[model samples]
Target: MNKELLEKGFIPDEICKVLPEGFQDIEEIASSLHKILANNQITNAVNEITQEKDLSKLTNSELERAMLLYSYVGHAYMWGKEEVEDTIPENIAVTWYEISEKLDRPPILSYASYALNNWALLDESKPLSLDNIRILQNFLSGVDEDWFIMIHVAIEYEAKNVLGSLKKYYLDEDFENKNLEDALTSIKKINEIMNRMPEKCDPYIYYNRVRPYIFGWKNNPATPKGVIYKGVEKYKDEPQLFRGETGAQSSIVPALDALLGITHSNDPLREYLDEMRIYMPSEHRGLLAGLDKFLEEGPKNKVVEHETFVNEIIGEVHKFRNKHLEYAKDYIFDQALKKQSNSNIVGTGGTPFMKYLDKHLKETVPKDD
Candidate 1:
């Protein structure tokens, strides 16, 4: 693929210049492409393994291993296609089915299900539907479902990376809050999946996948308009106004107004906007921009501000403790016939996996963009 991409002159010099610090060599890109191809080949090998209508040709153990291998291959191929913004050929799905037939296990069949159902939406260019969400929900509820994580990653990457322009397009057209909420929910589920992954996994892949969803979540109108700048001198041109009904000063309101202006494409040439509002010197713009920027950079710059870090940690801790207490008082004891310990829990209801999130908050301050 690298050779093809290089030959076709698709590798822009500027894009190559910013080739993500670790991916310095062209050969590494080639190797990654080969890995994707090799995975596809393994999926094809299932036909040979199952030939002559002979279930006796392969032992149960061999069939199980082959199915497991196919699952891994499908995941790798899916990730590769996403990274390059390319599509897998339709022939790949045939191979997926072939491999799935030989396998005795449910996991391989699950992958085959993903390949079939997902390809219809992804490769066949069908719109995302409530049915697709139901399928995803069921898959997540299934056992040994690594493909759920991969599928979650793919959806998130598409929503966050490519959907930003689409989101702005929707914003420009003034879509209703329900449409925006549905979009945000998709990304939110992606975040939940990413957060639930085991710590040993490479977080960069998860981060890259979920990064775009952040912007999608924020741009939605259903989000709360939190307090940003407080008691700071207001912009002379944008003075605080008193509401007729409440009689409270509209400091935060103005900040939100500015944000809507900046994000919703309300007169970009007016010089009042550049991604975020700035007249309010308080940490609102800084805080919001900080989170967005960090995620946008993926894992290249992992550090975060001290106050933000602390706040995030505190928030997660409170969330976990509350959920744990709720589950303990209401459900876990009945389901398992035993009390649960903190160590046995995971995610928002479990002990901290990323303690650095809170620690970084206390130790560092955010530098300006």
Candidate 2:
């Protein structure tokens, strides 16, 4: 397992090859990514996943699949098994319970479901209901110490934020004061619980698991931007928004396959078991132990290798990003900077400044030495 390769060091090249039209500064953009990875604490999280898995059993062809899977596992629970469908909260809680029961672990299913039910109060599709709001508030206030607290705390925090937004949006509309008070109180209680947990104990498992979807908190442009109000009497109702493209699964599958490429030996079962452990929760340590028995037989056919798969996929995506980056550099960034000149950016355009910065970066930082 080459660390630099796994870290997407070759993405820029892939981008350059795929989208040649507007990718002049692709190396520069790639350099910026390297800088971000070096600076951000998230690098530790990425490294942890990489170090834990021994990807020896995967074949060269399977490498892309493994890498894609690694990416997918990060958001497996958030996205549905299929595309464009939201993972229903009730369904997830039920799935967790079933998984837990199979392993003889006590259930923490109801807690997550409860949180989701509360979050639904803020769902823009339907009007906010007072009963749902009160129920959510009461549910949060009651939670103190439970096995589900780890997930519950995060969910409750999210619920509070949603409920707050609802109040803000519908200030003119009459809602129950009791519901608001209860929600506020619950929010404080959740904060207290979160404060007591260890630094490693992140309650936001939902967010972590659904990292890709949650990261880009933007509305899909393909859908209508929702209803707009004009003047005092005119309210234009927009067409209902439906998300057609959620690319999480496709993106993650290739990455996971890349890692799976490394497992080619006579006995790959051990390697497969080792790879799966990274995605397992801390409470399911025994599950990993049980999986050890299954890895006795190694992979039958050596399908792929990690390096080649990663490079290929990186190459493909690099093309896509380079196309966008070229558009940004040649058109959008400069236009944006110029029109908003009174704003932060200062220069003839964005590229020249970024180009200077890129040269400085290449000189100052040795290339992954």
Candidate 3:
């Protein structure tokens, strides 16, 4: 797809200039503002703005900065520190909520709003966080304008499509004996869609330009250490920042893994990848976990033919994941050339969980008694 194809309807003509050139000092300004919000000083500032009858009273620069503040502060409040409650505090939430609503819901503002409000609706006890799926509903409504957010919306679209196709088999009592070929076909279709995502959104540009501004935690080696928020003194010693890629990178991975019989192997790297699901909306996560259980006890356990078909599906899924890893590698190499940086890129391809599944599938050979 051409860049124009993605850019046409979503981005406004005025905001077209807002990204690369218009926001040169956004990082510095966003960092300073993040600290103030983190310190809970936002109540007064937010109250001041709430009193304004019209947002047009603010200058253009101020309006843009407010946009950045909504993005940064919202992320910091939700994911910055390891607070007991995952929900955003009321004072800060009201400020960003009102600001985002008044601005007609920009991509970042919508993203943060979904994170703050939508997640609380799901049951926390379930392993599969389906709340992530609820957030995708907003994306489907054409709220996301950024290329990065658009890519995620596309991913979730394809993922849900695959799941919807498989729902009938999941509900069927004779699902094991039902033609497994249909499920395989759906998996193949999803793989094709995923393969095109990087083409639609250039990973190189996304990593270098867009990724920096959206990052919450200081985990990315490419950027400086993340900013420290003021409140939650206990977290001062060891703060946790969230990178934008963490949630999007593997949103579909766990669900596919569960379908393909990829279990948690307890490897450190595998665990790290699994932990990223915490950032996902609980609803989608729960759906993945539920599908995993159904496969484990229903289809995979029942018949020899079903086992063979499942193994084939697992192989295809592994190939699909490896393709994504290749894309990551190519993006890193392309960026390295521009920066002339020699840093090694590790963990570029298959996760340990994927590898474990591949090995397990390979080792399971039919035996005659």
Candidate 4:
């Protein structure tokens, strides 16, 4: 163990204590963190630390707990959502963006993004949901790269179940009439999941530890101003800047758009969807491109059925979006009660994008239909 790193607070002490000796390497630390998470030792630690309201005043143990939660949640979201032969990818030691650029893949692509993006095109059954957005907005105290990563985890987890239900319904010819009902049922299940997420972390703590990493292009008084692509050298002088609803993490929205047959105008959202693919794994991005080609060149009758099914799915998606908007409002209001600014809540700005796509889908019908 690196005693200097632990003493300097570069690495959380709690994690250092739990880590196996000679795991002095940072990558080894990251790997061991996931092992503890997989075994469920970190669950209690996460719960205990999140209970603290003042992150600024957090003891060393509490800080360790938070770091472990952030690291493990991200690790699980990245590797654990699906059944992989190995929990950590062989390339786990590489810097995230470097792995993506060198391998031409999304650095942190998870099961949720993969499943939602490909489920419509691939004839595979997997379990998915969208309620994690609500939990993220309402429960999490801060937003950062790790926070963004976990949002995908939540999305993938919920989306897995939702996709599982949809796959089963579509595979069963007898359940033809119940398709819409099943989609609605999936949305309701997502709502139930959102209702059950434990509201732990103190917002103040989140602001102190996590918020600094999520700044927009506007300069701010923070150590890590916006996300820095460490291994990418082209931007050595200037790091990339991202605000709400931008970046690879937001891929779920466009994936859903593709699945639901919602086309976007040449607007910012459209540009965002196009640009965000750079952040996806190469194979995942290829699958998305394949889905587009499939939609364009597939058989007419099959396309019609897909469009009809997607229209129904979009209707449910609209309802889900509205539900999230409602939650955002309530969550922001709750923050107001604590005298905390509501500006930091996640998913607050998603309503406009959702509304735009929903309207677009409602106005357009399959020409074959």
Question: Largest lDDT belongs to which candidate?
Answer: 3
Residues 1-369 of candidate 3: C-alpha lDDT, one tens digit per residue? 111211121112221112233333433334355454445543333333322223445553344445545455455444334342234444344444444445544213333232222222134464222223232212112222233344444444444444443443344455543445665775676566557656545666655534333443434443235333333343352333443533333445565555444664455555555555444333444554565565577434343546666666666666665665565556544565577764543232213233443443343332211
Show where candidate 1 strays beyond 4 Å. 1-125, 133-154, 160-339, 344-354, 357-369
Model 4 residue 178 lDDT score: 57
Q: Model 2 off-target regions past 4 Å?
A: 1-153, 156-172, 199-369
Alpha carbon lDDT of each predicted model: 0.28, 0.28, 0.43, 0.38
Model 1: per-residue Cα lDDT over 1-369, one tens digit each? 111211121111111111123212221322243343435442343223222222244443333333333333333333333232122223333333344444421222232223212222333355433223322211112222333334433333333421332133232355334443443454344344434433322333222332111111112222223111111223122222110100011122122222122122233211222322332112233433543443344422222323343233233323433433433333322322233343432221112212322332232222221
| Global fold similarity of model 1 (TM-score) | 0.22
Taking all chains together, each candidate's TM-score versus the true structure is 0.22, 0.18, 0.52, 0.47
lDDT of 4 at 176: 48
lDDT of 3 at 19: 25
Which of the two, 3 or 4, has more lDDT? 3
Candidate 3 — worst ten consecutive residues by lDDT sum? Answer: 1-10
Which run of 10 residues does model 4 get worst, by summed lDDT?
A: 3-12
| Candidate 4 Cα outliers beyond 4 Å, as residue runs | 1-23, 27-97, 103-154, 161-184, 195-252, 295-312, 327-369
What is the TM-score of candidate 4?
0.47
